[model samples]
Target: MGKPAKNKEVKPKRNRITFETKAKIIKLKDEGKRNSELAKMFGYSTSTIATIYNAKSKAIVQRAVEECVPQGVCVFKTEYRPTVLNDLDTILYEWFKRNEGRKVALTMTALQCKARSIFAILMDPAHGIF
Candidate 1:
């Protein structure tokens, strides 16, 4: 019998933005600029910028509490699990309540802060960044 061919592994496409860059993107986005404008400003693909807007990754939620979460209030680990987002939401919602302001601005600020850090995590694997 002929030898079977080896299966090829396909890697997911890497995003150009790192978690740190995402933090910047989030900050820019919170300042009330459009995604197209932000993309042009940062030289990132509009679609990628849009992804940051949509908030798909759970890592942002995790990073959101890294600084603000009270000492011994919460702890984060490097493990990836399905329920992490739900827990993160609870933590973040509490954060939201603590920082009261116009709902729109507050939400924007939270999203931007977390997205910036989250973007960095996303890029670390592919771009050799933090």
Candidate 2:
């Protein structure tokens, strides 16, 4: 007897938007665009756009973007997780973007290996980040 195959669908991975994007959203909204239009443009749900638009810290986000730009830094999140290494996150994200832009296929094992290598190099005594 043959086993039946399980029917399941896989969804694309979702990425978190950056503070610069949030600032742009706020600016566009101030220019008279509606939430639905922004949502469609940003590939998010209308509710999400509305949430960003209605969030009380809109000015704060704008300020963060302006302040971080000249300093060559970014506000990745409202709260930082102690275990996360910011440099690792930035490097990994840039790596992902570069490869993805070239249409390269990335898998979990490849990503894990890359992260291990990056962490090793970054933690080395010779690395300037130290």
Candidate 3:
């Protein structure tokens, strides 16, 4: 006899609004369009339109769009990460740009290896990898 199958929990899909749409919503609102009107036009609820229209920082929203960041990510959170490798990041960025300029493409594995080697070299001599 087989045991009963466990019910799987399904996560709801997130509906991400693009930056352009958000900007349009704000522009329309500034032009005296009501939340309900904007909602109907954009196919979202009134609250959703109102939230974007009334966001604290419009610049953050615009910047996120220009950078291709998802809508739900906070701008401040994206600005900095406490655990970032500053020196390694600078090295990687320059390496990537140089490769791109030379028309040399690197695969994910190659990039990973490069990153690991750089990280190893930057590590303190007292705490060398075994």
What 10-residue stretch in candidate 3 is worst by lDDT? 75-84
Best by TM-score: 2
Cα lDDT of model 1 by residue, 59-129, tens digit: 48756754566433326454423244554566566666666654545657666787556545433445434
> Estimated TM-score per prediction?
0.35, 0.47, 0.40
Q: For model 3, what is the C-alpha lDDT against the true structure?
A: 0.74
- Ranking of candidates on lDDT, top first: 2, 3, 1
Sorted by TM-score, highest first, which candidate order results? 2, 3, 1
- Which structure is stronger by lDDT: 1 or 3? 3
Pairs of residues at least 3 apart in sequence or in different chains that clash in candidate 1: 18-119, 18-120, 19-119, 19-120, 19-121, 20-120, 22-116, 23-116
Higher-ranked by lDDT: 1 or 2: 2
Model 1 score (lDDT): 0.65
Q: What lDDT score belongs to each candidate, Candidate 1 first?
A: 0.65, 0.76, 0.74
In model 3, where do residues sit more than 4 Å from their true spots?
Answer: 1-12, 56-130
Q: Give the clash count for model 1.
A: 8
lDDT per residue (tens digit) for residues 1-130 in model 3: 9999999999767676866788788888998999998888889989888789778276465665547754333446655332226667888889988998998878999889988887777664644367
lDDT (0-100) at residue 102 of candidate 1?
45
- In candidate 3, the residue pairs with backbone N, CA or C atoms under 3 Å apart (3 or more residues apart, or in different chains) clash, namely none
Worst 10 residues of 1 by lDDT: 73-82
Candidate 2 vs candidate 3, lDDT winner:
2
